[model samples]
Target: MERPIGVIDSGVGGLTVLHELKRQLPKEQFIYLGDTLRCPYGSKGEEEVIQYTWEMVNYLMKFDIKMLVIACNTATALVLEQLKQNLPIPVIGVIEPGARAAIKATQSNHVAIIGTENTIHSQAYEHALIRIKPNIDTTAVACPKFVPLIESGNFVLEEAKEIVEESLEFINHYPTIDTLILGCTHYPIIQSLIEEVVGPRVTVLSSAVETGFEVSTLLTFYNLYHANTEEIHEPAIFTTGKLHVFQRLKEDIFQLKNASLKHITLS
Candidate 1:
């Protein structure tokens, strides 16, 4: 069987997750839908996020994807359970994988989680971590500015430094935490800056990497792993907002070539 996996995000942020999925499961095919038209689900109302997420999922279902990955943390936090219950295929979100990885990576029970406003406010990562280990301690910070900086292509500038420093003001007090979870997909772009600010000893984990491992494990358990034939194919990337930016960043920043990205309209 050659069924593809459906990965949807509110914008280019999800590309971080999709990149990991490809690296982990090279044989599997993937269909990525980035709802850039309604980007930044973080600031949106809960009802709006839910509707946009489901619409993206519904659109991807047209491709007959075997599994669905809610690659956006905001979307994952808002709509994961509903999608799991309502959709026929397995639906995996970035939160659980990040929580699991943080638990394992932390030497101290204390861990820090940074994400968008909605994702951090939802307390999804904290809940998942606490559910896994009740005694564990968690500190979550919402860095709303990070997403906008990334979207504007200022991720590497000195402005990003100021924003990162201002955003992580809470980290100064929590010196005990040895692991920091990059809960939002967009955070990976600034992982180096985060690591620099937190010092070398503190481990920075992005959910994208862990989610790929989770996806691989689930596929193995379900026997849905793709068997690659002699020919190789490129994954298709669809962006509802700005296609050129996604394409430029994917090739220049993320180094994801061969995959053709196109502009998509939701309707």
Candidate 2:
């Protein structure tokens, strides 16, 4: 199957996942839709998040995607199961892969998760972790400020460091937590800053890498690998909001200079 994989995110944060996907499966094509206009789905109500996520999914479905990756933690937490049940394609979410990675990295059997308000409120990561290892000690914190900061493209500034440090101060209380899961895909955008704040004592894991591996596994299991490997495939990127930041990140950060970027409206 040469059909493209569909990836949806609240914003460019999902690019972190996309980056790994492209690296791991260089021949696969992707169509990414970011609901940047309503970028921070973290604080939104449950119904609103579902509606927004469906809009993005419907938009990407036009491309005849073979699989769907819900790259936004908030949307994944609220809507992943529903998508898996409803969509014809295989649906993958960040939470489970992240939980699995955290479990593998934690030597203390204690892990901390940092994501958006809705993701934390949903207790999605906790449930996922506990489901895998019933005895795992999990601490989750909602960093309501992070998505906006990364979406603003100021993630590299000095102020970003301060905000990351402040937002993660609660980790200090969990000394037994040997691993920290960057629960939100957006958190990986500012991962270095996060690691600096959390320090070397704790290992920070991004679901992006683990998510990439999952996608690869599913592609092999489903026999969905693209038939043509000789031709270079550039992902198609779409955003519902401003294009400047998305363009910069796509080129400068993710280094997808060949990817086509466009502005589109869902409603």
Candidate 3:
């Protein structure tokens, strides 16, 4: 199919998932929308998040997309089921895949999830993990500052390491939690920093990679997998904030070549 797959997030965090999607399914096209204008949806009210999430969905539906991936944990937690029930196309989220991966990787049954304030509050990962393995013990931490650091592209700085360490100090007491789920899409940008803070005992998991694999499985199940691998199409990137911000990250960090990025406004 020529139609692209739509991926949406509160900001550039979604690029982590899109990056993996590109590697896993190179033949398919992608339309990534980052709601950078009203980002850090971490602290927003549930009603506001749902409204913003729908705005992104409405915006992406403008394209001829075959599927929709809610790459933001906050959005997925708040509105994924609603989107799936209402949208015509298939809809997927990052929570389940990450929960699944953690369930398989953890030996101690105690799992740690670090995400935005809203995502942690929603207990989406906890629900998903417990649903799959009822006895799973989940400890969720709200890392409110992580998203802004990543959104500003300051993830590689020394201060970023300090922020990661400070935010993750709570995990130190819970040493039994051997598996950490990077619940926010943006968290993957600072994966190495997180790994350093958590040390070798805990295996950190990002939903980005697992989410990409989930997309692949859905594409095949829906019979939407592209037939022509030779004809590759550059993913379209859009931001409801600054085009330059998205452009720089797409170019320097994401290293996504030939991407056409534009500034857009959503009502």
Q: Which candidate has the top score in TM-score? A: 2
Could you give the candidate ranking by TM-score, starting with the highest?
2, 3, 1
- C-alpha root-mean-square deviation, candidate 2: 0.8
Candidates in order, TM-scores: namely 0.96, 0.98, 0.97
Q: List, residue by residue over 110-173, the lDDT tens digit for candidate 3.
A: 9999999999999999999999999999899899999999888767889998999999999889
Backbone clash total, candidate 2: 0
List candidate 1 stretches off by more than 4 Å. none
| Candidate 1 backbone collisions, by pair | none
- TM-score quality measure for candidate 1: 0.96
Against the reference, the lDDT scores of all candidates come to 0.87, 0.93, 0.91
Clashes of each: 0, 0, 0
Which residue ranges in model 3 land beyond 4 Å of their true spot?
none
Deviation of model 3 at 259, angstroms? 1.3
Candidate 1, 1-267: lDDT as tens digits: 489999998888888998888887777888888887777889899999999998899999999899999999999999999999999899999999999999999988999999888998999999999999999989998888888788777688888899898998788898788899998898887788988888886899998888999998899898888776554556889888877778777898666788888887775
Which of 2 and 3 is ahead in lDDT? Answer: 2
Rank ordering of all candidates by lDDT, starting from the highest: 2, 3, 1
RMSD, each candidate, Å? Answer: 1.2, 0.8, 1.2
Clashing residue pairs in candidate 3, if any? none
